[model samples]
Target: MSEQDLAGKVAVVTGGGRGIGRSIALYLARAGADVALCSRSNGEIEAVGEEVRALGRRALAMAVDVAEWEPVESFARAVVAEFGRIDILVNNAGGGFEVTPLAESTPQGWREAVEINLFGTYHMIRACLDDIPAGGKIINITSGMGLEPRPGNSSYSAAKAGAHMLTRCLSLEIWDRGIDVNDIIPGLVATTNVDWAKDRSSVESVLAEFEGKSPPFAPSERVKHPDELGELVLWVASMPAGGPTGQSFSLARRPF
Candidate 1:
């Protein structure tokens, strides 16, 4: 597809303040789409919005906690008020605690994980469902652990897995309405979200260990860069009407 495919379009990206979300927002802006960036942090969202404006596209940055329905709804209203329409939705905000043994996991930890990864995504999708017109796109950012069991990170893995299934169900329900829903199961990506020094001395030391665990045959043969995933998001969102939908795309090589 060409960059102009998204020209004059409007997209809302939750967690668009930094990391993969930031890249996706910028890519959409570069593709000529007016973008609304939402995150819990106003400073980061505003910064990315500035970048979007630099790309010559209309940008709105709002502080939104996607887990809360009110903020999510307010953000949607704000975007519509400014841009007059919503053409795409990227459910990208997510959070998780460090891996802990299932036996030791607390109810609070599991609840937070479910709230952020699953409920947050649901709120965004639901709030924008009617806003996105026919032929619109919805991309849910999932994780590789969502596909298979993540022994230590059980709460996060379970929530993301449910989210992946949620994407498929939404696609089926909305197919006749021309709203396409799909998901991206990104492998480990280098992001500030990572707790690099939980046990290691520094980020550099942690990164060395991470690099050693990298999968072969993967694009770049290492953990993905945030912008690399962003490029894929742009492609999926801009794909022609007949392009793939209701699919789970993995960014890493399949172990089997």
Candidate 2:
């Protein structure tokens, strides 16, 4: 698709204040889609909104917690009110609160993980379903942890696995409406947020460790940049109707 192929389309991205979500919002704007972004960080989302507007596309930024249905529903409504319709929904608001073995993981930690990752995705999709027209696209940003087991990431992995399954189930349920749902499993993407990288003293240090480690299966493994992931998201959103659905695309160094 051309750079402006998404012209006249509207998209909503959760956790769009920073990281991969921020990149996705900017890329979608670059592709000519008006974007609505939300996150708990008001300053970040507002700054991203400015960046989107700089791209000559309409933009809306709101402070929201996707884990909470009320805020998500409000966000959806606000987007529709501002843009008139929704064409793309990227569920990217999630994090691993505590990476510990299942036995050591607290009930609250597991609940938070699942609610933020899986339930948040569900709430956003449900809240925006009516606004999204036929042929709309839903992209769930999952993780390699969901596809392959990791020793200390049980809670996070379980939540992401649930999200992966939700993508397939929702794809089938919404098939008649012409909406396509898919999951993206990104592995070791380089971003500002790297709480898990305790070994690295800085972001650059973390990235350096993965330098020249691009996996054969992915475009790059040397710590995939956020924009690279945005490119993949744009490709999926630009697919022709009935092209592909209920599929999981993984961009990771290790095999799943």
Candidate 3:
């Protein structure tokens, strides 16, 4: 698609202050879409908003925790108030509280995981359902761990799995409305938020390893950059009203 395929459209992205969300927000802006972004961090979202404006697109940045319904609903309303309509919704804010065996996990940890991943997506979708027009798109950023079992990250995996299922169900439920719902499962992406020290490898090495594996979605055998994922999001968001929906796209190697 061209950079202006999404011209005159309005998009909302949760957790759009940094990392993958930030990339997606900027990409949408570059593609000629006005952006409304929310995250827990005011500074990050504001920075992103400035970047969006630099691209000659309208932008609104607000502080919101997607786990809570009130703020998400308010955010959705605010976006419509500012932009007049919502065309794309990207649910990208979520993380694991802890990586540990179920027996060793705290109840709070599990709850936090579920709330941030599954419920967070649900809240964003529900809040914006009415605002989205007939040809709207919703993309959820899940993880490869959700597709397969990870011994230590069960809580997070379970929540993402639930989100994956929700994507399929919502796709069917909303098909009559011309809304498409899909999930993107990223594996071992190198982002600023990742702690390289914990992995005992440089970003270059990680990229090399990932490329050598010949992942399914990456035929170029190159490291998957955040902006590249943003390109994929743009493709999905620009799909025709009756195009593909209820699908899961993965960017991970086997065993991820």
In angstroms, the error of model 1 at 133 is 0.7
Global lDDT of each candidate: 0.83, 0.87, 0.85
Per-residue lDDT over 155-253 for candidate 1, one digit per residue giving the tens place of the 0 to 100 score: 898899899999988988988878888998767677777653243453344456666565332434465668888888998888766567799777766
**TM-score of each prediction:** 0.90, 0.92, 0.89
Local error of candidate 2 at residue 7 (angstroms): 0.2
Record all residue pairs in model 3 with backbone atoms less than 3 Å apart, i.e. clashing: none
Candidate 2: lDDT over CA atoms?
0.87
Candidate 1: which pairs clash?
none
Supply candidate 2's per-residue lDDT for 256. Answer: 83
> For candidate 1, what is the TM-score?
0.90
**Who wins the lDDT comparison?**
2
Could you give me the TM-score of model 3 versus the true structure?
0.89
Residues 1-256, model 3: lDDT tens digits: 5634999999998999876898899889988999999998799899999999999999999999999999999988889999998999999998855688999999999999999999999999999999888989999999877888868878899999999999999998999999999998876575655433234244445465565564454454345667777878888888888888999877765554
- Which window of ten consecutive residues has the lowest lDDT sum in model 3? 194-203
